[model samples]
Target: MKNLCYTLLLLSSISSFAQNDSILNFQDETIYRINILLPGLEIEKDVYKDFSVVGNLGLFPGYYKNNNLFSNSEEGFFFIPFIDLQVRYYTNFNRRIEKGKTIVKNTGNFVALKFTNYFGTATDHRSTESVRIAGMAYDIQRTYWDHWHLNFESGLMANFRC
Candidate 1:
């Protein structure tokens, strides 16, 4: 009886160290997105306490409008390959936590500097030149029903042809 008591006491006294992360100030994860406007893979990694860097490789599908007198206006599916990167600063982590909101999956308001490179535009007549665009934007991200991610962003982008 004494030995069993001693063993139980020793086991109870042993320390177990683990991360309790009950309250999160920021998000750290790699997200695979295919059902959004930009379908691709992206990862958001922490660069500072509230700052993170994200990279994406995806396909851009849109319309091509031509305004030339010699040629007719043809509206066809234009699919282009692109790569994008962003430096994001999450601005509402503490506020969301205070409001009893779940901060899982990086859902919050953020300001980001975004950069993207287009390999080429796909159209009836293809262009061999590439384009680069850089911009800064305010973004809002949210998850609905735990799986659907909705995002909205608005900003000015400058394009450079190369």
Candidate 2:
């Protein structure tokens, strides 16, 4: 009788732990941003319970035109790369339900710290110009569509160049 009771206790504990593991599992997402028909890729991975990291890569094609803002004619191509580390403290992690489904709660309000780097070169009618920019920003994302699980972000950024 004593051995049977111990076995049952162990089994119960294991089942409880398994259930909790499912509830706290990590989620991941991949996104693409469209820039005037050019596409950029971004990947986001959950790190901790309420934190995640995102990385992005984008490219812009070069063009030549007359009466350009920088000079009579300018042409250049460039790459933009950025990384963002953010935390989302979900206000309704497990409290919301829709159409008999438990609403995923990671898409909530968030604060983010971001770093961006830009390097490029442009050629004008008279001279060639090279530019490098490094920037940091603090951003906030607010949930706009709770049912559809969408959020928008706004931020201020500062840039430095060498």
Candidate 3:
């Protein structure tokens, strides 16, 4: 009886000592974001562990020269409405975690394929009113001040008919 009691006690102690803490893993989450440079609103839905679909809406300045059907030598800038969607894969979660960086809110290095459409006309640009752009880009995004998203991206884009 004493031998069995001692064994149980030792096993309990070992189990207690082994229960320390869980290992740190990657962070992925759905987030609502805003772009500072373009002043836009974005929604990112996490569909998988490292993949997300992001939708953005914004306005950009478009310069137009009055050369259309009902214009006469007038040039001005207008706010062009745009929308885009991106399928982003966060690629460097392990590397960022190993390097002791915060990976909260799906912030990390990513490669994304994007499609953007502009549907606003700067004058009477009926032929150019709607534009389709597709691109593949590599991006790195990091959080600052716990809530700021700072991102940099480089990519190749092509404008074509859709």
Candidate 4:
């Protein structure tokens, strides 16, 4: 009995020695930058001199920062990925005609799609765990001179814990 009691006491003391009674600030700080190149192509071209395809390449870059209430000891790093795509079409036509002059009007349409994924770890001084989130979104717009315009957008999101 005495040996068992002594063993238990020693184990308890060793565990306590691993912990310090110090106050700690828990927060996460992230400084990140990313860039993306998106290309859009019009399957068919009707307004250009030649009935060929029209396309445009777009480049965009941005920075992001986040400060979490928890620090590294109790916090984990994050990994995020995002993408966006856009397309536009433009056309011009004569609205009115006269013997010597003519009036013209402009019309255009646009579409966009976006997606994002966020995954990381969340920790409390002792152990770190993983967290993940995902989402997808899309948008469309159309316009015509002296006519009705239309716009549509939608999104879906999901969150996971492990």
Best by TM-score: 3
**What TM-score would every model get versus the actual structure?**
0.71, 0.46, 0.72, 0.21
Which tens-of-lDDT digit does each residue in 27-77 have in candidate 3? 456788877778689998988877899999998766767676765676766
Clashes of each: 0, 0, 0, 6
What overall lDDT goes with each candidate model?
0.77, 0.47, 0.80, 0.33
lDDT of 1 by residue, 20-119 (tens): 2553455455556554677676766777767888888887776656678888766556667889899998899888877777677778899999999988
Per-residue accuracy of model 4 over 47-105 as CA lDDT, tens digit each: 43211222222222223344556853233343323233223232212211212221111
Over all chains combined, what TM-score does candidate 2 have?
0.46
The better-scoring model by TM-score among 1 and 4 is 1
Better of 3 and 4 by TM-score: 3
Error of 2 at 61 (Å): 7.1
TM-score of model 4 vs. true structure: 0.21
For candidate 4, the 10 contiguous residues with the lowest summed lDDT are: 23-32
RMSD of 2: 10.9
